[model samples]
Target: MAHERIEVDLPLAKVYELLCNPVHFTKFLERIDDVEKVNSQTFDYTTTIGGEEFQWTTNIIDNLRNTRFAWITINGNLNQTGTIRFTPLDSGKRTRVDFTLDYRTFFGEAEEDLAAFIEELPVQLKKDLQTFKDLAESDTFKDEESSSEKVASEVA
Candidate 1:
């Protein structure tokens, strides 16, 4: 479960490029340390999640010509298969991305229900889009938590 939708201001192709590049995941997925291609169709990912390090493998299922792409996570706490659809809007100046995640929990786990997870997904997903937007639109990207300093002027 845990369905989320994020819209990146970048073009469909640009977003697609970022998705296709497995190595680039480390930039956003801070938990992911490295990725290696085990074969032509499989990629292994090494990540440290919740202070626990683990490895996972995923397979590329289908990919359309800048239209849709799908994949599945072979092994992990987040076992889901989803697709990303790209739609051109505003006369191709912008692109709309539709992302869906579908998965199941073992049972009696902390996060089990899919519907409930989907409900509160927007907040987290939107934040991710903001970060993605900053990276895609400009060459600069601030750390996940970087704040601007406010200096007080002497008025008294």
Candidate 2:
């Protein structure tokens, strides 16, 4: 299991909106190569780690609006489950994100390999979280959100 936390200078709903969309993950998560939405509640992700590529399908098991989101792998080479919680701070002007991921290698893997992977997981997760923070705080993200809202309103 690995855990990472970051505070973003954005409203809870804004941060949660980005987190709920798998397509946005590639923008912030370095290891993620691509994400395909299988359905409203499921997604397929392709990622590369240490020059090795992996694919996984995950189903969103919990989604509590701007409060919490959780998912578990349904099938693939990777066995993983993760949860992200959003906490509003500064009276909803800011958000604190807590991310937790638990994963394991396939059976029969070398013990040393598993140990090394575990040791490096936290460092990678921290870096990814920082990237997420930067993305959430950037003007590009804000502009994109505003544009999308305008488009939606026009369509309605």
Candidate 3:
């Protein structure tokens, strides 16, 4: 099990909305190559990690608007379950993000391997979280949102 936290420079609702879109996962998650929506709450994804590419499917277990989003991988080379919780801070202009992951590696469950993963996981997680922060603060994401709203308004 590994847990990490990051503060994002965006409103809680905006962060939650961005995260709910699986299309943005690859942008923040390192080595993620593809994401295919299996259903409203399921996704099939491909990732390259440690020089190997594998496929995984994740089923969303719970989503509570801006509070929490949790999921479990049902089929994959790696078995993992994770949750992200959002807390409004700075008068709701920023969000404190909490993330947790419990994973069983594809490698044999040797004590040494598990320990190594445990030690290295935090570094990867921090990098990914920083990537997410950058994306959330970038103009590209804002442009995308504005474009989406434009289309929505036009359709109505």
Assess each prediction's global lDDT (C-alpha) against the native. 0.58, 0.79, 0.76
Higher-scoring candidate on TM-score, 1 or 2: 2
Ranking by TM-score: 2, 3, 1
Clashing pairs in 2: none
Candidate 2: stretches off by over 4 Å: 110-118, 142-156
Tens-place lDDT digits, model 1, residues 26-130:
555333467667776677776443455556677878878678877788875545455767787676667777766454333345333443544445554556555
Error of 2 at 152 (Å): 23
By TM-score, how accurate is candidate 2?
0.81
* Winning model by TM-score: 2
lDDT of 2 by residue, 20-71 (tens): 8765666666656777788999988886656667788989999999999999
Q: Over all chains combined, what TM-score does candidate 3 have?
A: 0.78
Give candidate 1's error at residue 33 in angstroms. Answer: 3.6
> 134 in model 3: Cα distance from truth in Å?
1.4
Candidate 1 has which clashing residue pairs, if any?
A: 1-103
Which lDDT tens digits does candidate 3 get at residues 51-146? 566688889999999999998988887666789999999999999999887667666763554446556777878898887888788845544433
Top candidate when judged by lDDT against the true structure: 2
